[model samples]
Target: MDDDLRERIETAAEKHALLNAVKHESDADVGAIMGPLMGENPDFRQHGGEIPGLIGPVVAEVNGLSNAEKRNRLEDLAPEELAEMEAEEEADDSLLPDLPNVEAYDEVRMRAAPNPNGPWHLGHARMPAVIGTYKEMYDGSFIVRFDDTDPETKRPDLTAYEAILDDIDYLGFEPDDVIRASDRVETYYDHARDLIEMGGAYTCSCSGEDFSNLKNNGKPCPHRDKDAETTLDEFEAMVAGEYSSGEMVLRVKTDIEHKNPALRDWVAFRMIDTPHPREEAESYRAWPMLDFQSGIDDHLTGVTHIIRGIDLQDSAKRQQFVYDYFGWDYPEVVHWGHVQVDAYDVKMSTSSIKELIDAGELDDWDDPRAPTIKSLRRRGIRGQAIVDAMVGLGTSTSNVDLSMSTIYANNRDLVDDETDRYFLVRDGESFAVEGGPDTAHPPLHPSFEDRGARDIPVGDAVRLESGDVPAEGDRVWLKGFGCVRRESDTLVHTGDDLDVVREGDVDVIHWVPTEGVQVRMRTMDGDVTGVAEPDFGDVSEDELIQFERVGFVRVDDRDDDETVVYFAHK
Candidate 1:
């Protein structure tokens, strides 16, 4: 083939190979590149048999590049194709199975009811993520309900209400309406009164031990036979704080001999002396139980679907009695098994995390080591990554253990192109080079040259990790600078020839100027003190950046003395 034709064929092959490699995040196959290359350039079809031989070398070269490098090259060579591929992948990643009996309802309405004890953790995300997706799928309304009725036991924190909403918003599932069970004590009270009037509930003055002994044996307490008039009057007195906590509780009427003991005459409302966190609720002494309040609120708020853990299947059964009493339809419930994340050493519980924070072992809910959604956001993890990870788990009843690496992989794909690259060496040590260029300009982001580069002012010295220093007689290429050889404790600069390092097995090391800024990076493992490129200081806080040879980090705090960052992932 002529030189011009040969050059065009090779360039086309390189572009196809890079694109394929980036799409799969793996090595490119020569066979895969051939079809695209020939299809795009019909002239190459005539030389089809010889095309493989001609482009085999090109495919091999493209495959040899790292995933990031392949992506960067593809961005430069075929930006439109790369963008199209990314868009297709995103669409594929967001695919979800259609909800069962979705056509049964005129308008699909879902609710995410979170207990306002603390900010949401990774486990708490499944409800909102799944419900939010369903809401969008049916073009329906989404409600955020705070299940904060139990002000004594699972006490509600005043700050947790806003924090939970903020977390839901951060996950891109903004609620159409927000409801607090605490604010609706009167509504629950009215429902309780109606239930008593219908002979579906009664006030029980039995002690805890006596009630449990009776219920465990498939029997009802002494208050079970009370008439509606007497029950209603006793319930009113209970609501008026006529009895102390544990002295009386209103029980829903159900089959005492029910197979599931937990569903047999469950408690609907109980008297609690402890004041509620909210001032409005503090005045109300009687509070409705979770199943009772949520069941009533679900109907009142027009919720058509409910998503909860499989372990709470009994909750559905308990609420069914209440639903049947009012002649109201229960929302379609989708139960997912427990999702145990292997990301944290500590248990991913609000109480446990709060204990650590109170004990001074952790900073707060958003600490880098915490598994809360706020921590993930503070550590530079995107909301899309969390949503994608949760959605990929699907709505299965089988318990599943998730690794954080899956989230990290998902996040890497998102932040790779957006984050600029810089060098940061932990406990960096200065290396004096005999001679080299006075300045080096490295591209801010390898995939986007239009974003420009960082002007690194280099003198005769550069800083590298102390343990990464080359031994005597070892030649290493200082990235963005010329080659250098360590000789008897003295570093000597060689020539600035790219081929020299590429042709040989010379090691390429990332380095910053001796005058680089000091950085303290907080990671899951611990704090790592490092020296970063001077331009790192110019980066705005809360922006994600990749540390060359290190991992991704978010600028948490930037100051004149030193910059603080949180390590995201590799």
Candidate 2:
């Protein structure tokens, strides 16, 4: 087999296999490469992409594919298409629309508000990232509301508000202003009063158990017969703390015989004994239920559109009911399927992440192992990479985990050439050069103009890797410096003469001249001892580099003489 024919066959086989694994790409892509190769080399044979009259199917253009990749795509097509391969390639942009026709508005004048009982997590970030991205595209305003009326379970820290705000800012989302449920308490009371007057909502004196059982089968409470005047008085008493906690509850009067039990007579407000973190020990004991708060807020804000998870699909039905009672316009709601963590094969939940953190298995909320935005950022995963991984997954009604780290791996590979390389030494292992012949030090990333050649003087006593140091007559690589047939591990490079070397690696290890400054680094896994790359003192926090053969690294902190860094997971 001649070199040209052998090369073409290998390339064709690899392309064919990659297409098999790349579920997103079609076979026609393989023909682009094979056409040129088979035409140039007579010995090569092609399978797909040569049918007489069949035209090539159009495929969406995925971002980040190189021209060479585009060529490889041709080989996967039918053989007939190769003969008529002169068809022009028109770029596909269906995945992301130009959206010129979307009417832009400045502010949401609309309804469901954020659940602010906890800080934003990866799941919480999804809608906001999409909405915020769209919001910015149209210069629109989004309200950041604190759904704090449900004080049934309050965070220990009163500053839960600030923590949520901080997380939102960290993710770069800019809301128009802060909206709190407490601020609307009087507004809710007035609306509840009006609903009672209209007989659309009723004050229920039923116990928690009775209230739940009431939805199972329609039955009117003795208090349900009270006139609007009496119901308003009772609601005022409940708000005024005249009634003890849970003594009276307010229920929206949906159809009592509704088939969906969840849609029937849902509680609109209840009294909770627990003191709110924000409100402190005030005697105001009544609290608005989540459904009522969210529904009314979205309506009041004039939110024209709604996007939430499928798990919250019930929210749409319930919110629609609220609109029906008030005769208000219902907003357009678009729900997305669930996002799951590929490794766990379960929906990524903040509670699970917190559980891991609480167990001490993960370093912090932002630890790369936790899969939070901070964690991904710490891992050197760019925001755009996360967004891209999400965007291409075809949206379906069914829930599935689309996350795959390999997408980030593929992205990182494209930018590898631009990454600087550094030699990092492991503990119990280090290299020494026979110091005699070298002249001056070369740069860590050698320039292409100078190639990789160094001007260091010739040395006979130069050291080989401690591992590759020959037992007696083993050969080893001197790395970019060159290969050397090692005679012994003890050969230290003294500043004197040139030593000849050849390649034979048991394993290539790292080295630094005995005289340079010694530095210590902390990797994500553990502490490692390595010669710091020269620019380690000069590089900014955002800069990342490949630590030679070890892994990718980014310097996170510089403490006096010590450096703290994070290593990429293998």
Candidate 3:
């Protein structure tokens, strides 16, 4: 075959291999290559029998090159082909409408206010990508503000603060500033005092059930009528720790008959005696509620835009009351529907997940099965793929139900072009072969010549998967080698011509030398043990590789004897 035909076939093989990897296919079936190849080279439709002969050498050739070199060549030699592939990978952003008043601000300021109580999950992963895109669109500032004030419920972890920062950095965002609500409690307190003096809030001394009863009845509490002077004095005494927990709370004044019962006289501040991890222990018992604290912080931080879920519409309403009370303009609120990955049903709440983690139900925040960003990173999911997935969802107000496969699809497009290929044999069973070649060579990558090759010594005896032993008289091809017919534990050798097995429809399986290094792979469900090519023994920790016919895995641990990998996807 001519070099151009070989290159095109190699590209076709790589595309099919990547698609198979995305589908978690064990092997890139020859039939799989034909369809995509015919799309690029229509003439191949007529040369059906010769297709397999054309594929074997090209598959071997392209598998030797690094994913990066394959991509470069496609861009240089097959620009149109590469463009088509990229267009397929491009994110759909039709729902992400332009920001309101984009030209009104001197410089747009957007913030991702994640409460530093737990690591971020796929749902939370959307915030930075969405907010960062808005920031970049308007040449605005991207900020991270930790809303970590609810010590009793959504408790703060100092470690989670850095973990969130790392996640933000991983998503390719460099925040202009990082603000912690715990560090700005006094600022919120100041806003609270001003609101009390303005008669927009008051100190309520009613019990929880009593206030619930009155609120349910659409009646004001007895203390709701207290003058601003008396209420100010009561608040001062509560702030001085004179009032114990449950004895006092600050409630924002709103219409008692508001449509939403929770909105009628919402509690702005409450008492939480639990000592904060990062803040002083029980230094201030009275704390502002999320609505009050976030409302104050957003205004003071000069945030121009806020992107969050539709469930927070009530929060926006409550914060708007505070903004109106202070005669301040509310930031533009862009709310999207909640996104749930059907494959990932793990709790999205940091507090709940932290409880499980503390009880030892999970390995850590970065546990491969966990839904957190750290866990995704450990599983070999690329950050860019994450962004693409989120952006593809856009800012639609309609609910989105998806699966992990959506994210993996985007990831495969990226990782497939950069990852190298290797062979691995699982469920290995030994058998002695007669008359097979003494040595075999397979390209490290198929497309790049400089990637070199690995030599496998094909001795008389060979080990194959116990399940893959061909029936007597059946032909099988040992990858990188020619065909053989099964006869008991020995194989009758076939000619070296690639077409012999292609014409006979012989099954092909990957094999590793008996001397190949052992591997223990940690998959999403459990562990998969196998023997890999000796070339894999040199792979470093954190490097991603595709174990041909197995799956893509990230080297988690590399020792002198064996390697441990985290299975990313099929």
Return the top candidate by TM-score. Answer: 1
lDDT (C-alpha) at residue 161 in model 3:
88
Q: Summarize candidate 2's per-residue lDDT along 1-570 as a digit string, tens digits.
A: 345434445554444433332433444353454455455434444333341111122222322354456445544443223211311111121143323324653443322255555444555555555555556656666667777776556433455567666655655676776788777888888888878888877888888788677668776555666788888888898888877787888888777778788888778878887766675434557877877877787777767676666777777787677778789876666666876656432236656766777788767766655556665566565555454444443344577564444334434644456666555444433334443335434445644434342333333333222444455554344344443433354444322212322111133444443333234544444456655533445556756766665667666766566566666532
- What digit string (tens of lDDT, one per residue) describes model 3 on residues 1-570? 456555655666666654543333244466666777777566456666777887776655555556665566445655544544554544543246788887778888999999887778767889898888777777889989998888877777678889899998888888999988888877887888899989999999889999999999999988888899998888787677777778899999998888788888999888766677774545877888999998888888899888888988999998888999999999988889998776654676666667778888777877766777888899898888787777777788999865566667677778876678888887887767778678778777676658887777777667788878888788788887678888887777778567554333677787766778898888667677888887787778899988877778899998877788888886
lDDT of 1 by residue, 409-463 (tens): 7788888999999999887777777877788888898779999998888887888
lDDT of candidate 2?
0.56
**TM-score, cand. 2 vs. native:** 0.73
Q: In model 2, how large is the Cα lDDT of residue 72?
A: 55
Tell me the TM-score of each prediction against the true structure. 0.85, 0.73, 0.84
Candidate closer to the true structure by lDDT (higher is better), 1 or 3: 1
Best candidate (score: lDDT)? 1
List pairs with backbone clashes in candidate 1: none
Ten residues in sequence with the least summed lDDT for candidate 2: 85-94
